[model samples]
Target: MAISITQFASDSNLLNTPLWDKQSEILEEFWAGNYAIAVWALGRRSGKTLMSAIVATYCATMLADEYKRHLRPGEKFYIISVANTIDQAKIALQGVKDLINGSPILKPLIVRETTDTLELRNGAVFRALTASSRSGRGMACPLLIFDELAHAVDTEAGNAAGSSLYQALSPSVAQFGKIGKILLLSSPWIQSGIFWDLYKQAASGNFAHMQVVQAPTWEVNTTISAEFLEQEKARDPELFKVEYGAQFTGNIAAFIDNQLVDAAINSDRGLLPPLNKFNGTYYLALDPAKGGRDAYTACIVHYDGELVVVDQFHQFAPTWGDGKKTQVAVSLVEDWILEQHKAYGFASVVLDQYNSSSTIQRLSGRVKIRELTWTASSKTEAYSKLRELFNGGSIELYPHPKANGQIKNLTVTYRPNGTWGVSGGTGAAVDDYPSALAGAVLMATNRINKQQIIPAKSYRTW
Candidate 1:
């Protein structure tokens, strides 16, 4: 484990190479460190690929030797590697090939040939893969390397490329105590991608013995000027930060303005009224799904200015033929309303009226149903009002664990025209959470202004 710089270069045949500068020094330290996970965010043309190839060769040789000494007949040693795309995988393999071809001591390892993989002489294998096309359910590797970690997109299944790739290596490493190593190298692109998630986790002590080295484009290569970077930022501010500055920024095209949303969230104060005041008036707001797995059936409970998110129900409904599912959904809503009506005596249940009119008709007798329509103007107005209410500290939330999780996952981004929208990746909104919260605020504030309130009439003597 105490790998010296001279040993690494002599064994790998990279002593006289162009990458044997200060950058290689950092990589050498990383390789010899005791960290379980090491992240190297190298800049453009800073010889990152070459350094990675050298590291891969070193690991392959070391793991192969270890396997030989402790050989079980059926034991498999794997060097699992990943890239962003097929072409990138090929490029990574080319680096591995370069190291193999350069080193006189390690040149005989080439045993197989393909577009994206190389089989070694000592029964060990180097498998190149793209993050998007990864199916790592059965893969078990003692050594795992993820190249260009920042380019992977966020998926609905929670494990973005980095997480998924790591999950695949977990089983293999679990058996080999203190022998497994994971390497992650990338030029930072988006702030909220797989790289950022892993970095955050590693930073927050979720992962043991993790080392992070951030090599900015300028620091790694002096040719990358500040003026040139500024021009790139002017063209596309979001892309520039990720590409050159090596910063992790959430979705640049984010729907909601993060600053506005952050301003609205009152972390200091708990729910507006204490949790004991459960007898107040309450109403449910629903945002029905459009179709497919993309959308979710969201529901929220409104009690005064405090928005208590009760549940978020999501199901993929392909066939809307007779709308039987819609009716069933409405029936369930009716039952919930009746139960709540017996307790809080809600004035009226409000719902987005875009796609659920028939469902509304089905529940006419059981409760007072109000169909809420949102126009482009109205939507803008409502969002503006919600922003104001949030900034003004008028909104309160019940400290429910599920609600807190959703809120933590909530992210906002500004549009090109300076408008805002809300979104989440691991915690994206599927149902009426955002809309219902907006609706509750609007109903409390706007109902009085619009004169849409239905007052309890007095039965006077005729």
Candidate 2:
């Protein structure tokens, strides 16, 4: 008799309790099909990691002998599990370890274990890796799993990296023919990427062998109450549509182009020397931290006839303590600004009004302060100007890791108020870096326009 996934779970010590109804359905459907790829668009807390662990574990142990039959003498095969980051990949691998640890029947099969790999005595190996096309290359993988695949995009280009990664690994996966299996699962994101493409294809029956499942949190977990979902929807309806409703958000999109940002970065350059090293007037911009949750960030830039060059970027720690028990002193942050002003002699300083009144007062007589009270309209204008500079090749960025990261992760969302909001996306905790950079660019652009230092055609859209 052929082994069923449901029967394997029930008979083995894999789970302390019986599988959830929806989980069993998902497993049964995939197991019974001749699918080379199974794409799951599930809601948050819907047990994606757990499901991946179960499938990978089963193939690595019970089906190891059968899977290795086609391999040449002494050829190695891998059951690879990947996630957006190393930390996330570790969580998936830990899920497999937890199952093995709890099961007396499966525990003895482990011949060796490492940080990112588990090797069974039957010569089958399970490895966890960070999501990258390079990482997937040159491996003979029979089983491959992608957790939170929707977030695996090309950070600089603001496009999906999933297609490139899939292409790189698909040849190896195809080598196994009927034995090869690829599992991709994530909470639904924007309507782009390989996940969305595969989902639509499966729905249209374009591929007769592919399996696709769309499961909401309540359906899969059953423990999430309606009251909790109600509160979440009330908190953020648009976000709720994507997170709980398991729907794609058409309003969400990447703010900047990858090649544009890449070309703007001066890779060989470090932070430019202060005002004395250059002849152009300098502009400084600050984005103050709030509630001890964000970094206090600042940027310094100047227009040098042809381009707006970012000379300096600074991000002060928001708090210091073993358990975030102490907030950073505002006075210390002010002192650092004062110190920078002395070196740059900024022609003018621009800052958002949020949590910045005290800083303005301290530097009142010491510097020329231009207070910007951000409104929906004003932010759109400022951020739009920054994007224009990037597209026109009118900006040059010094090497700043935080600034680069925030720029790459920025998202543009259409608000209900009939305006566009530029903010951070998943895994981007704060956008202070880009905020300050945009402010600095806006100030420099305005000053250059007022002075008529460059031809109108030179910076018309820049």
Candidate 3:
């Protein structure tokens, strides 16, 4: 007797509850025989792993039945699950194992079971593997499920292993005069990599060979509480978009969550006034363009006893001209800072490590300028701290269209070693504002309540 997926899942622990309507839709799509590829950009806790496991196990078991009855001898088939790490792979493997175990009629067919693979009486196997160059090879499998693909690291064991594995499986998937399927399931991340590319291609209807299903957390996982989604929204709006809304953030991974940036933007204030008479310590940070071609931006932050607000944001042209011309650009920046110092007392000036040495040399005695070289690790740290400040609602932003654009352009990248890198989005016109803001955030943590604000001076030394 042929056991249907419905029979195996009926009254079982795995499907004891009613299937979410969206899950039914996905299962129907998989069995529709219309699409060769399925791309799932679903939110967290949407039961992606569970759904994938059911389909993988059912297909492997059912296909083994076909091979046993009608296929030629010595032929092998497989259903393989691929994840970015061994731990992640275990998730898929565990789900499959549980479903196979919970089914009353399906348990007897398993001839052998290892930590990562299961072999049936027939020459069929169900395996879970990682996204390493050495993994997922030599398997002439029919179906492959990629779990949480956005975080798949490159340069692991040399080269892009995920891409390599895809090439290896593609031929087999299209062989045997039978249609094969590939499933890509993940949460949203930055707008890069295979996940984004394939999704866009499919959605555009440009690739008839691909199919996509994009759903928010609530739409797919009907069991989840609205309160949980609300909490995530409150915690970080940009994060909520990725986790619940299932939307691509931007070009690069946004380091500071969008909700934080949104919360900080003060719509009441347009561009900050040229100067202010506020009685707070002010810190100015400069990220200058190497030449006048790029943007040279300075951001000033005011710290009262308990609150921090961006009081002034300015962008200068790229480093301009020869010695004299360069000096003029320098004079413009220096003069502006000095004047702001008079309007609102500035305690210390923070300089980007790669900023102009000439300008620093010229302003040494006028104000305390500390230059900290920004490395990958240092930039990660500063951005992380800035994110923390925004998460806690500790920083306020004065509304300026350019500043808003720059802040939103901030992207974060993760290394295989688990370190983070923050930068502006690809092809951004200006990153200076965000860079300077990050520096100011780092300096703000060191400011003291009793610290002196450098008062307006009577004499000019420069």
Candidate 4:
């Protein structure tokens, strides 16, 4: 017996009791198939995972009878969710599983479970697949959900995630033609990628196949704390606007986009030995806290003429003794640099003359160190080199959340004098970590490039 979704929704208790107002409207728009592709740019934790699960399960179970009728003999209908990580993908899967077990009407159709999919007796399947370019291969899915399309666009899921999934699954929908559905929803990230493009297209009212919904966190989930958002706005106003205010803050202004940073992550302990342990030509960069809650930073980088790989990075904020704590922090930073130099065979050490305190003078006796002044021009140059490394895809970054977090939060700011420099973007604790890494990379490359001035065979001087 075929049952329409409206009948199922009314009787089967498909959603939670007392649904939020907008959720009802979204659900209503969803089942009506008002748009073949829907883009929801929602604030964080706006119940997107639950909504995604409801749609997937409904298409897989309640609508199974009618949708199955469209399938040719031996063809199976699929409801797929592709997310950045397995855990992310499984969230929606768990949502579907929970709903099915709770539903008296749909629970009977779940016949079996495989490693990656749940099977229904009505010839429908629900799959939770990690966003890998290869995940969509050989699937005939009519409904697809891309959770955190922004994360997918920036990380390992780049090739197989977000819009990329369309190439693989679009063919599967050839049987259903225009009836197949794709819902891409996420908290805004960079201003680039498929989600942003779809939103702009929908805004223009030019794209007939797509519709966009942009809502602040509170608009979608009224239960969210206004107090918390207010506190966060007080803490970092720019970030709050982008994250919770439903604003498409320009990602172009970021010095390092998440995609570049995600691609540069090189932490696989077994595959590639860490820089702290590996024996290689290493360069060390150190930054000192001037005052206040500023952090002291150290970053180590190695260059293979072309690629700059950061092997180690460390940073910490000084306990606020103000002037006294800064001296202690500098001493600690220098000692740590000495330890690293002894262990890793650091070839050169780079430090800003302005922030080096007496660390440079103290280390002069034991190790070779170069002191460079940090003006707007020097800072601009270092940042440019860092961008080149990322642009050329030649930077192997040590995977540290502290450093990566700073990297992602770094924004490029142009001064009145037309010089480009980097400042920590919204939600960053401090910009010291990124500055240290930039200094290390600049020194590593400069050391090698200067060597090129003297022909390799003619003179062994750099």
Best by lDDT: 2
| lDDT of residue 87 for candidate 4 | 80
Tens digits of lDDT, candidate 1, 129-223: 77766554455566678887766543554325456655655565544456677788887655555577777777676666787777667777766
In model 3, pairs of residues that clash are: 238-259, 253-412, 291-318, 291-319, 292-318, 292-319
Off by over 4 Å in 3: 1-7, 13-18, 33-35, 68-75, 101-111, 134-138, 150-153, 156-164, 188-193, 200-211, 234-239, 248-307, 310-394, 397-433, 439-462
Q: What lDDT does the true structure give each of the candidates?
A: 0.58, 0.77, 0.70, 0.70
Query: Worst ten-residue run, lDDT, model 3?
Result: 451-460
TM-score of 3: 0.63
Q: How many backbone clashes does candidate 1 have?
A: 8
Candidate 1: regions farther than 4 A off:
1-7, 10-22, 69-71, 74-76, 133-140, 154-162, 191-193, 205-208, 223-234, 252-462
User: TM-scores across all candidates?
Assistant: 0.50, 0.59, 0.63, 0.57
Clashing pairs in 1: 191-248, 191-249, 255-421, 256-413, 256-421, 256-422, 298-431, 298-432
Candidate order by decreasing lDDT: 2, 3, 4, 1
**Best candidate according to TM-score:** 3
Total backbone collisions, model 4:
2
- Candidate 2 C-alpha lDDT tens digits along 1-462: 266777766765654535778999998899788688898999888888888888887887777777778787777788888787789889999998888777888888888889998887777878888776366676788898988877775555344467777677767687788988989888887777777787888877789788999988889999888999886765445556677888876766777767777888998999888757564389888888766667778899898878888888888765575566345677887788777778887777777877877777667777777677677666776787787777668889866777887898888884321245888764323698899988787777777777421111121111
lDDT tens digits by residue: candidate 3, 40-156: 899988998988887787677666655344345677787888887888888899888777776666677678889898877667788888877345565567787888776566564
Of 1 and 3, which scores higher on TM-score? 3
Q: Tell me the deviation in Å of residue 353 in model 1.
A: 30
What are the RMSDs of all candidates, in order?
16.2, 17.7, 8.2, 16.6
